[model samples]
Target chain A: MNNWFKILLLSGLSFFTLGKAQEKVTIGEKQNVFSKVLNENREIWIHLPKTYNDKEINPAKYPVIYLLDGEINFEYYTGLSDFIARTPYADIPECIVVGIKNTERTRDLTPTKSQKKSPVNPEVTLFADSGGGENFVKFLQEELKPFINKNYRTQDYSILVGHSFGGLFAINTFLMHPDYFNAYVANDPSLWWDNEVSITRTKEYLEKNKKFPAHKMLYVSQADNEEKQKNWNSDMTQAIEKFKGIVEKNGSLNYKHTFFPGEVHGTVSYPGNYEALKFIFKGFRTDIKQLAKNPGLLEEDYKQFSKKMGTEFFPSESYLNIVLKFMKSNDFKEPETYFMNLKNKLYPKVK
Target chain B: MNNWFKILLLSGLSFFTLGKAQEKVTIGEKQNVFSKVLNENREIWIHLPKTYNDKEINPAKYPVIYLLDGEINFEYYTGLSDFIARTPYADIPECIVVGIKNTERTRDLTPTKSQKKSPVNPEVTLFADSGGGENFVKFLQEELKPFINKNYRTQDYSILVGHSFGGLFAINTFLMHPDYFNAYVANDPSLWWDNEVSITRTKEYLEKNKKFPAHKMLYVSQADNEEKQKNWNSDMTQAIEKFKGIVEKNGSLNYKHTFFPGEVHGTVSYPGNYEALKFIFKGFRTDIKQLAKNPGLLEEDYKQFSKKMGTEFFPSESYLNIVLKFMKSNDFKEPETYFMNLKNKLYPKVK
Candidate 1:
């Protein structure tokens, strides 16, 4: 090859390599095994926190956040989690986010079958294939759960977040299997589903069931929509208010609902998720030393608080800090013995 | 080739194309031009806002945030911007960020020559060749500026953001070319540069110059550092305070200096940028009618605000809303004569 041509080729090659080096790491080649359980191929994005791979830090387990519409909402949730985890005010424990992508979104998310025309494409044939919430829950419980447990170091705490159609699925799952998740976030659920069958079912369920599991539920609605003819947001607002009323009347339910006046449907999900996390972890204080006297005392208090709030029992950063402070405060004496005994009981047979 | 082999090759080719079709748009790309002046000869990353390239609406010009040490910090800034832009309380605008990758970071960012030995490789004597801020500024001003202007629809309001060593260079550039950028955000600047020569020079410059141009400057420092033994932050703070005192004694000057109580150097930049932008654009409300009436209003307001704050200005969504509200309110007026006359005064030759 000519010298000039060789140099030019080398420069081009260098530039190409430089570009490759600068490119952000996109989705990896690993196929999500969870997709196979749904009997469909779809992408799943998993974000392991910064501390996930550290060998020095043993007994590392993170609370998991399962997000629906993984392809669209995964980035937003992952980013929010990362931001909050790093901040001083909301120094939430590092979380493992499992972004579950959709194969047949309409099939899996819809709670009941209804004959309705498509809004985006009106020309499409008017046919509805819905009511797949049970199978979707089965996929999450039987297939996805085992896969995540096997692969990741996860704590008992778990949150299920969804929006619109996915929100319908989330609420259905919460009502059907209350023990599965610790927290549920439904951002503008299509409560208008099949003339409010889910809401009606919820009312019946609340009346019959005496004891509802402790879990945090945040239901959010947007300000304006032409769908509510009388007042722009009144229909959705009323639906949410009525749903909250049912939960409240049950006396053993925990829920929080918010109405964002200016936010549209598309934009509500991001802020809703952030606000939900903030509200769920609102009581958690970073100053853990305050509870140093008795770790069990702190846990007992948290448990009772969770029961009162109708939320799943989980120890936040403050709770963990209190444990650490108690252990270290007394020159690592009886507190250390207690922790050692607790650890031994938790992980029996481990040396 | 054999028939089976040929079929396999064709199938592979088709799959490759399919994969490409399915791939989501990643953050960074090779040789993607941001502006006419800022063409990517080397590897560079550009973050386009969500509304970018929306043809249905008139193209919105975004404030450009340029990050130093793009190779290391590009992903972080991109992630930070994405998170902040989506948050409810955070009014920071959705920005088009240009992450300028470094060729020789030490050569470019440093403002003065260094004879200090390399700590990492002390066996081999190291002569630090520094003081390249002037040439670096020229490259940014002449080459990158034109490239960005030509390719992207950008607001005249631009932010120069940097950390540590890069932070020093940002301050140096702002002092030298006050009119080049609207705001200068320096996160923990190396004010102790070459035994505080730069700081000394800054003092001298302030003493000599009577009229300082209108611009915003934010100097952030971390709590704990060995170099800050003599209360470095306070010293630096006092120096800037004294400099400001001099400027204020002479006339009015815009400046803001803050110190993070417990945050270290590495973790200060993101939060610093967030707070700085908030502080800089604290009360800046945009008037859309004013922008329409006087097209130069956006540029003028940005300049005036930055000058008032003494830091680079970043307008948030609220600021845009104010402008939009102004435009909406004024556009309904029956007589368009006032608007036309104002436009003529602003741009005499255009009409």
Candidate 2:
């Protein structure tokens, strides 16, 4: 090839790269999973945490959060997870969020083949294609989990989060297959399904097991559905309260139930999810200021947190770097050295 | 071209288009604005609401939210706004979020030349490059706002949101240029800047005017900052409380102060921003069930809300569509016709 032609081609390629300079800010990627259990192709939205791609740190495994109602919640949920998982005062371990988009909302979420008269129109029925909740859970455990575990750098610990009918699915999955996920979150769940079948399941579980499982966490958020003002003792509100009463009485499961007074059924998930994460990872945040005086406290805190969680978690290189920067800037020389050693120990040099 | 060659070219073009199908879920776009006032280029992140590009609806105008700390807060804030503004249960109008990325943090956000000894290390001084707040606001007012208005379909209503130093800037901006935005949100603002200069400014304004602007709204959120346990009356806490007292005593501005019991400075903004939007658009939510019985109630509620806001806020076409769907499905023929007429009146068909 001519030297001038080669130079022109190289210049054109450089221009194309420059033109492709990212104009849109993206949060997650779309991955299609063919689910044999459901006999369908499902699209999953995957959002990796900030440190997942950081070259400065060694490759790390992250807890996976399986979120239901992907299209509605994925955008905010991903951003919120990253925001709360920021270093130095991290509230939770950085985790990958897998948002499962719904193809058959009623079919995949309802645990039983039950139909209800629509609130607006009694002639019209709701949840006609229900009873596939068990099937959906099977897909998650058998196909989706393996796909995520195979493809991503993931930790053993995982969380299942859902709202409304999705929330019902989370609780049912927890009751049926307790070992599948480490923690469960149900936000304004449709616990009133089939005359409160969830309450019956809870009672049965306690009767059979004598106590809820240890180390497994459940967080349920109940919304103050204003409809109760008009129809006193609405089934939706009553069912949740009954479940809360039963669970609290049992006192074996690590559980937290928050009732947001002003929040409606549609909006309770925002604050509920935040509180759920904090509850699930209760001891995750370590004081950066305290670290200046006592560097060893970092590991001690993590040790205590891990013991409570029944999972192993270590300080990320990114977090250690943040701690080191704080210590160095604040003139805590000994602490700075301690963190430097900690970072090296946790994330060894590649070469 | 030959018939075979034409078919082959068409097939290749279709293949290329299919290969370029969307893989990443995007929330916003990045736009760089040249600010002659500041003599620099500023990158702005812009997030449009869901219905912005819907072919089914006519082009509509939306309120814009000017968010500070663009890099840190833009992603979640946009998502939160969209979530809250979902049709049929919208707590606020759909909004366009414009997040201004920082160039020089301390230089642009602080109101005056200010310096403070670091809490961790007294040898280091903070805000050395301060006092450019006025200039930054000038750039926003003169350059950025014009660029946004010229480019996008915008409503007259706009909100200013900020956190920490950015929060300080929001409060200062509200006080100095009250008419610039309809609402202001300051999440855990650095009210203690320059030994509580914001407190002095608040007092001075109250004394001079005896009342704040009638329609403008301000929402301030104070974090619990667990450090308060160690130092009961820290300057950060004291300054914020003092400002709150002065403003509340004056009782002129549409103001709200929320003390988040467990939220720290770093994490308060997530919930704070959510509450701030709710506070600003308190009367925006209309009951779909109520509308089924009283079709005229929608317009009445909007009128009352508009009167309170001192701005005209018509029912959005998307919202009207949702209302129509509810009425149609519920067999409320009269209400369905009423909403269809309302939608047509508000947003006429282009043809």
Q: Listing every candidate in turn, what is its Cα RMSD in Å to the true structure after a full C-alpha superposition?
A: 11.3, 5.8
Name the candidate that leads on TM-score: 2
- Write candidate 1's Cα lDDT for B65-183 as tens digits: 88887755555466556555552233356678888878667777888787654332334444376777777787788767666666677877788888877888887887778778877
- Model 2, B1-351: lDDT tens per residue? 443443354344531121123389999887655566787657789899999999899998999999998999988998899999998889999999999999998999999998877766889987789989999999888777877887789999999999998889999999889988899999989998887887788878778888899899999999987563445226678888888888888888899999998888889999999999999999999988889889899999999999998899999999999999888888999999999999888888987
Q: Where in model 2 is the C-alpha error above 4 Å?
A: A1-22, A227-233, B1-22, B226-233
Q: What is the TM-score of chain A alone in each candidate?
A: 0.73, 0.92
Work out the TM-score per prediction: 0.55, 0.93
> Looking at candidate 2, what TM-score does chain B attain?
0.92
Residue B38 CA displacement from its true place in model 2, Å: 1.0
Interface RMSD of each: 11.3, 9.9
lDDT of 1 at A58: 50
TM-score of 1: 0.55
Candidate 2 TM-score over all chains jointly: 0.93
